[model samples]
Target: MRPEAEPAMKPVFAKIGKPVAAKFRPDPFQLASLEAIRDADCLVMAPTGSGKTWIAEEAIRSVFQKGGRCWYASPLKALTNAKWVEFGNHFDPANVGIVTGDTKENTDAPIIVGTTEILRNQLYDAMHSGENLNCDLVILDEAHFLGDLDRGVVWEEIMIYLP
Candidate 1:
């Protein structure tokens, strides 16, 4: 006699759902952070993948509308570059510039994106030259990296030096 055929096994995972076509809405926390930053200094602490970047974008938009400059510092070169590209797309390529140890372009753009260490060095230079950093808003991404033993000091220096 032939062996009985085994029953088909069920799939382990659920089928992927169709992508939702929903309009984007800002979260209350993001709006609050934007307002706080507009009024005074703000330290936003949220889990990764949350809308922390949205607050930064709105704040930068406000500054740009007033013809002011902005500086965005990230802990890693890759992150800085990614933001440089992302901001370029959002704010226009002509308005975005990047300055790092390896790359420097469009230094006079209204928006500058660079690594945290470069920002610290610029602060040092500005202090030595008795001049202020020509930026209205300064956003520090991956700020928790400020607690790192090796590079935390640079972040601390930036915090202390930036007005």
Candidate 2:
């Protein structure tokens, strides 16, 4: 058999230009998430690129606008650091802080990003001190890690201790 063969379909060489600029509109589920977060605890589960981060940003925005505090926890330091920058861009650099195993800065900012372990430790400290966790809202990104074999305990502890 011949190893070389012509393409089955012609490549669209002309369709490779820059995509048309279009305004972004949230999906119905994203809108619903934003509404649900306003008055209640909400868990959003969607596929990648499905606007879960948008929902998070909006929730943080709502709280930040009202002079409230938000805690955003992810399972990894890399993700936590990325969100810190993203939230800083959306909410202003002075308003966002981060605390991980190796880094802690601006711990007094209105919006905080950190790993689940850090959050759990903070909860432990608050419990030990007889003080409440000073947070108005909490977002647990990569929340499915709650079922992970090794890391789930940290996430579970954070969930149990959060008020």
Give the Cα lDDT of each candidate.
0.91, 0.90
Best by lDDT: 1
Candidate 1 per-residue C-alpha lDDT over 1-163 given as tens digits, one digit per residue, 9 for 90 to 100: 8864344422322245467899999989998898899899999999988999888888999999999999999988898899999999999999999998899999899999999999999999999999999889999998888899998998899999998
Clashing pairs in 1: none
TM-score of each: 0.88, 0.88
Q: Summarize candidate 2's per-residue lDDT along 1-163 as a digit string, tens digits.
A: 8764346433554456678999999999999999999878898999998899999998988898899999999988899999999988888899999999999999999999998888999999999999988999999999899899998998889878888
Report the lDDT of model 2 for residue 117: 87
Error of 2 at 99 (Å): 0.2
For residue 16, model 2's alpha carbon misses the true position, in angstroms, by 5.3
Off by over 4 Å in 2: 1-17
